[model samples]
Target: MNSLFPILAIVRKDISVWLRQPTSIAATVLPAIAFMVILYFGAQAVGRNPVALVVQDSGPHAQELINILSDSGAFKVTMITIAPQKAEDALRQVKVAAVITIPSNFDAAYNAKKPDPVTIHINNLNLDFTNDLRRSLPAAITKFYADQSAINGNNSPIQIRVKETDLRSQDIDLLRFELVPNLVLLLTTAGIVNAGLATAREWEDSTIKELLLAPISKATIITGKLLSGWITTLLIAAVVLVVGAASGYLRPAGTIYWISTLVIVLLIALASAGLGVAIGAASHRFQRVTAIGIPLSIDLFFLSGGITVAAFLPTWLQTIAHFVPTFYGTHALQMAIFYSSNEGLILDLSVLGATAILAGVLGVLSLRKSMLA
Candidate 1:
């Protein structure tokens, strides 16, 4: 009880100091929320993009393809009966996201069983817009064939039947689910940098030297600092979760899902706090902490697949990322919230738990050594 008093006192003191500064809370939480808003608007823009549909064939087959595009609802189709050059001009002027040109021989080639080509001219300035066109156009073509086959009672030579099964039992918004996990990693990175900066501030203000003279053990002091950081990170994570929930991005599987998520978040916070403390102990200046913390946080985020899809990374980088704590943290949250099964959950949790313990030990030892010197 006697030894615990110092740790408790330090925690209270740190919390009080943090609560007095509203700017700090704003700095930590607002940007995360703002990013969520940006994602929501970006999704909306992607959903309803307009495309130019240039129809050179007036035959029933050609008109059927154009009708298929209009009915798909993935795009707003503008039928351009004018010259293909005018359609290309529309694309260049950004009046449409893409231009789809149906050849004059489209119906003739279908009847004669010859090759027919449909041209699509699109601005590749935005990769997302171009990709959307690529996907939607093919799906429209498939639908046209299916519709024709259904109408003509098997007279059409080509027939395609699609059997769709979800990887999970329930439906998930692919874009929202993918981006929300990245937001969790962003929150963790912010926690690490914030904690490191706060710890370095004590040295900058000469208060850490005074702390060295206190009767409490250095271990207790270090634990107290980590505890304060852990608490702050947990609060920030709560805000992020709330934002995710409000955005309709996160779906709760059950109470256990949330409970497990919270546990993983706490472990991540502990690891981040430990890393921050180690950086603070090594660098006595706040500038050094900022310099080290920001880049280090970015690297961790990149390794954790927050910047890009993990499967797309190089083989060596993918191997290296396996050792990164945030990788496990992000994976754990993704499995808990997005996936229906507990596949890989135990492995992810074990890695995070081990990382927290290892980092905490090193951070405490480093801080004790720095302060005692």
Candidate 2:
């Protein structure tokens, strides 16, 4: 159709514009990286936190456990030979993260092979110590002794080591949760630029009029603008996704799952662009655009559940959340990118696709005023 050329030419010019304007590229890429990088290091430090310990042990095995805990360097072990009353006071005042009490009968329990039960008093919620330190000791020592005994022909598979991961998504720790968030930022920022300003900017600068005056029908001109923004947003998403996958963030959740996620993210960008155009076209001032667009952009991303959970909200917020595309997109992206949640991918795809279509229609309808003019 003679109509299609205007759209194509518009898209071509848009890409060329961005390529020439290096600031545009930096704006989109740098902010997402900053958001992700800041949190990754923070989470790593928090999760691997060191603790302080108060030990009340003097016997050989007690000394051995103390030495092991000390050499492991997970905690700063303090030698507390003080009165039990003093130790209790110190613990109550939060002077230590945890206290280990080895009963005077500890050696009796070890010699009787009944196992010495060391009481662990924890004042903090660091489960790493619970899961790996106190819990791991008996098994580790048993294995160590058993391996030594095996050299003497004891012939017993007496000790076993079991490794467990966080079981969240993709065997990645809470740290890599950054990928989805960074991507969402990428989507939303790009969406606002493409949707809010791209089409409207052209119209404002009289570029749209020139194109319209040239040969493009009003329909093709609008479609081309919408498509241009959509392609730009998606192209960035795809590049980040490829980098994420190669960086071990992509981590094939499932073939279908990944495909659907890709579709939904693109669709969300398109819809967001349409909403941007509708909003931008309605106003002539950048201040009004930011006033209206920035708040909506943030609200949509938050509603998307990229970082927050909808279930935790009061009923009304969650009810309104159903209207948010990022809510569905994030939920779906999580499934496709991390959990490989199969059902999640399909549900997200359908929801996002519907939104994209609706938004595109809105952008097209937004152009009716231009047509009339």
Candidate 3:
């Protein structure tokens, strides 16, 4: 009971100091929020490209094809017109990605069973947009043929059919998929920054000597500091989770999945807090600690597959990611909340648990050395 008093006092002192410094709190939270905002805008720019449509033919067949293109979900028809010149101008001015022009003789060619090609004036600015435009036209044409076949009681010339089977019950959008890594980043930043700041404060204010002279063991001091950071990170993470759930981004299916997600988050926070303490002890300066801790957290986030899936990265990058603790943390959370599956959960938890123990040991050793120095 006597030992617990000192630990609790240390924890309370650190928390009070953290609350008094608003700038420190902002430094801990803003970078992760900024990353999320920037990624959200990037996601918007990648989906549904804008294009122009020019219909020179007034026939039903031409109109049907236009309707098919509009409904394909690949292109946003920003400009629709009868004049080909206008669409060409829009394409030239960069108002649209491509100009699709239905030739005036399209209906005649179709009726006569002759070849008719729709001219597409594409900007070809980049392969991503160009490839999507390239693939979408063919898909639209295929759908048009199928629709015609159904209406005319005739076989469509294109025999290919694609049936998609999803492995999971729900589809996670790019923004929501990105939120997983962002959440991990937030936890990491909170843990490292808060704990690092707390330790560095003692050194910066020349209070380390006083702290060392107190009638408390080094182990208690380390435990108190780590626990303070861990509690702060949990509070921040809870806020983020609540916002995500309220906004309909993170939806854990069952109580078991929620429990698993919380466990992973707790492990990540504890590991990060331990690392933060070590950094703070070694640096012993507020500016230096922030310099190291913030960048280190950001770098870990990228190495842990920041916005992209680790599996889709280059072979060497994926191999490197496997060694990053945040990689397992992100994967564990994603599996728990998004897929609601226990696949690879045990391995992830084992890695996190090992990392937490190793970090705690390092933190204790570093703090002990710093105190003696």
lDDT of 2 by residue, 269-301 (tens): 887777776666666445666688777777776
Between prediction 1 and prediction 3, which has the larger lDDT? 3
As for candidate 3, its clashing pairs are none
Model 2, runs deviating above 4 Å: 60-172, 309-317, 370-373
- The TM-score obtained by model 2 is 0.71
| Top lDDT prediction, candidate number | 3
Q: Write the per-residue lDDT of candidate 3 for residues 185-268, one digit (tens) a residue.
A: 899888888888888888999988888889988888888988898888887788778766665677687999999999999999
Every model: Cα RMSD to truth = 2.5, 6.4, 2.2
lDDT at 213, model 2: 79
Please, what is the whole-model Cα lDDT of each candidate in the order they appear?
0.78, 0.67, 0.86
Candidate 3 regions exceeding 4 Å error are: 26-46
TM-score computed on alpha carbons, candidate 1: 0.90
User: What ranking emerges by TM-score with the best candidate at the front?
Assistant: 3, 1, 2
Q: What is the per-residue lDDT of model 1 for residues 42-108, given as tens digits with 9 covering 90 to 100?
A: 7665566678887878999998998888887678876566588787887888888888889989999
